[model samples]
Target: MICAGDDDEDPFPVEDCLFAETFSQDTAFTLFGQELRIQQVFGGNLGVAAAVWEAALHLCSYLEERSVEVRGRRVIELGAGTGVVGILAARLGAVVTLTDLPLTLPQLEANVSANTPSSGWPATLPTVLPLSWGQDHMNFPSDWDLVLCADIIYLPETYPLLVRTLAHLCKNTAVVYLSSKMRKEHETPRFFEECLPSRFNVELVHLDGSQNINIYRASLRKDLSQDLD
Candidate 1:
């Protein structure tokens, strides 16, 4: 996604992205070649961390196309609403950990279990957890090979901590894939400016199948990285 303050090219513009569809809590969809069902909570009952946003759709498709490279990797997905992106990663053969706010865990777990049922699911079903960005108490395994986040840069107040969390967890051997709708200009630029140049190399991915959403691949910079303490 184009950072809000960025003057660079806004590739893949979404001229008609204003109109979005509403779905029932339980719905069926296909990602890549896999057919899956998910349960999502919406309306007043759903929090920002629980809604199935558009960015995840595009992220899942990209994962499908890059399935081979994703296989056997240990992935951690932040703000994993409805568990869609992580579920797709699990389908792509990655060991995935899907996380959201504490309140969102039940819903994320439901979708993860529903889509990857025990009958057909292998022993490696995705793990669901509560993770507030920048919170050190988040109980997750270390050494994540890949980190995925979508639509998380909308809040400016959270950007500093969010970027810190991203950089901290993704220190070594982490290829971070971030997807988000390019909105709230200030927040986006703050995220890129605070985190990218020093600790990671950011690459904009041209996603083919979505509107108003962007994909970025951030590889940790080994040479220039520091704890920044």
Candidate 2:
């Protein structure tokens, strides 16, 4: 199923045809303390991921009251399927870098350009690039202050790659924010539970009143010695 941000110019027409929907009408959501323009898409088998995005947006609104040094912080988002989380962070004063597989870069950039109005991006808006997990380390400014991913831990085979990518990108005190719907039936929660805590201090933030969905926050443990093993 195609998520809401899938582009129309996908060259792999066969793979592109696998998705049922195209970019939907632009919808507005406030995430990470900034107003973001979003397109709701069909997650197909990844419906839970879409739900997680909704939950994160709700949490973002609630966190607005309490500032947490986001201004001018370098950030990177991995497996940015729909670019929702990354784009929102850019609006919230973080210098975000959005990445996904090369196939998804066009859609990702389209999403960024669509959300970012011509009035001009705050000098803090993010840059979009083709970053695949475990492919190669991105040569950027410095270690990221924050790394974000929404519903990225869906495949068990992807765990090792994600760990390596996160380790290379995050700073000593970097905080990584990940959100999911806890879809136990899909084995996603189990995948995260078994893999993430080995290197990060995983915390399940209860996204209760503000939104009707479940979400969590995982911050990297500063002292982890997780190796390439």
* TM-score, prediction 2: 0.74
Give the alpha carbon lDDT tens digit for every residue of 44-151 in model 1: 234454456778887777776665367788888887767788887787678888876665677888888788754654437888776766665234444889898877
The best candidate in terms of TM-score: 1
What would the TM-scores of all predictions be?
A: 0.79, 0.74
- Lowest lDDT sum, 10 consecutive residues, model 2, at 10-19
lDDT of model 2 at position 180: 56
Q: Residue 5 of model 2: what lDDT?
A: 28
